[model samples]
Target: MKDLTILCGVEACAIFQNSFPEQPTIWPSVGEANRIIEKFRSLPEFERVKRMINQETFTEQRLKKMEAMLKTQQKDNRHKEFTQVIIQRLDGSSAILPLKTDDDCVELDNVINQFIKDIDRKMEILQNEGSSSNPAPQVS
Candidate 1:
């Protein structure tokens, strides 16, 4: 499989793992990711999670949003590091690993934290781009 990065949150991860138990979906916010970690910590043992990498799992728009967020993250310095990333296997099992450094997380793991930072940044950009404080008269 190619490099597939899902932009999802911790809570959404838990919900998706618990609810779907078949399809894998990435959450697009830090809040959701935190929730998933918390859920797992509360659990008695680690749960195996499965994630399917395909069009059915993610929308084109969402993917584009992730790309945009990535770009935004690259430019911003506020959020440049992440502690961990959750890796889900094809069989529906998952593990959370700490991100020690760029060397520690190779490719996908390196981007996980930046992706989280970009989610909100992308949303903020989208929102600002869509809204206008004052409605101007049409020149046409």
Candidate 2:
């Protein structure tokens, strides 16, 4: 997969992207993504937790199992957010496999973070190009 590199070094050629070797999607996906993430960030983590547990096993035993395992996590604040993404990707679609462990969740979080940064940068550049009469190409 190619990625979008908005910020670059002084050389403007050091930013590497593997996902977006060509151009970005010609849609309003970035701003919508930012808005969605903003809304997700504002919600309580428990909301995602409930959503995850809803379609899966919500037994007290299972909850305790996950709770104890995640008790020492430093990502409690981002848990719901990460969880929401996991569920959305895993459920009602065959695009991605479901996250069954904390490790999977971590990996997914990293992937999502990179995607978010890349997309936001791409959208920024595209928007700037659309509005600016003169645009300088950023080395990638």
Candidate 3:
């Protein structure tokens, strides 16, 4: 059996998204992405940030770790499902458990923010002229 050491983060997301056809005819719309992010931000798990509007749960340290983890995974469909889970969690879907406590909320919020940053970074890298490697296997 394989291990799933990394928590939900940007690298995991990149792995999943990288599998998309080089030129996807149907990419997620900006509105959808924003909605996903917005929903993630509001999930109960992010209470740390909610506790203090000025505090930064999305710290640089965690972001870097998330980035590192994201880089290790292979592209897969899990990214879409992960995004959907976040969206559902935020959209008042009672079928799932809400972020339990302040710490959980804050931690998740930080991770989600980091995931966004990772995606943006990947986009930037993709836009720039660069060398490439053979893609890895899809995780899911």
Candidate 4:
């Protein structure tokens, strides 16, 4: 397996986190980051940063992790089809909600997949920009 830490140092990764705080992308946890850093320690520092967010390396792992989380939260709905409704009342307002159906679950799954794809697209842009082996010359 290719080590991702080789793509970016901890400081550079930190800068990326700070630079995009609100972005929906998943930031690797500290332990994960540390492991990646250790694994790729042999690579040059700049090369590591360039490959920091390699999709081919992390995408499947991340998807599986996300799937596990979703599984833990999943409800067993073996019963016959039904609609779950929630009602709410306020001083001057009322609202109602229904439980998700099979279609809803499928739609949500598609959305999650698409969301991952979007994150990959963003990471690709960052990776390409970072991959330059030479630093641009500084202006006087």
TM-score of each: 0.21, 0.28, 0.27, 0.26
Q: What are the per-residue Cα lDDT tens digits for candidate 3 across 1-140?
A: 01232443321111124575674332245465566566667768666355343325557657788887776452223444445667787788754534566755665566578678988999989866343454556798
lDDT of 2 by residue, 1-140 (tens): 11332343211112233596775552235565566556666778997455344434667768888888787474553555565665676676434545688886776778678778988999999998887966668799
Model 3 TM-score (2 dp) = 0.27
> How many residue pairs in model 4 have overlapping backbones?
6
Tell me how far candidate 4 lies from the true structure as C-alpha RMSD in angstroms.
26.2
Model 4, position 36, has a per-residue lDDT of 56
Model 4 stretches astray by more than 4 angstroms: 1-99, 133-140
> Candidate 2 has which clashing residue pairs, if any?
1-18, 1-19, 2-18, 2-19, 2-20, 3-19, 3-20
RMSD per candidate (Å) reads: 25.0, 30.1, 30.9, 26.2
Q: Rank the candidates by TM-score, best first.
A: 2, 3, 4, 1
The superposed Cα distance between candidate 2 and the true structure at residue 33, in angstroms, equals: 69
Better of 2 and 3 by lDDT: 2
Q: Model 4, range 1-140, lDDT digits (tens) per residue?
A: 12454555333223143465584432355566566567688788997787666777699889999998776555333111112111122233344423267766664455456657988999998888887756778899
Best candidate according to lDDT = 2
| 1 or 3, greater by TM-score | 3
Clashing pairs in 4: 6-48, 7-48, 7-49, 7-51, 8-48, 8-49
After superposition, candidate 3 runs with Cα above 4 Å error: 1-84, 87-97, 130-140
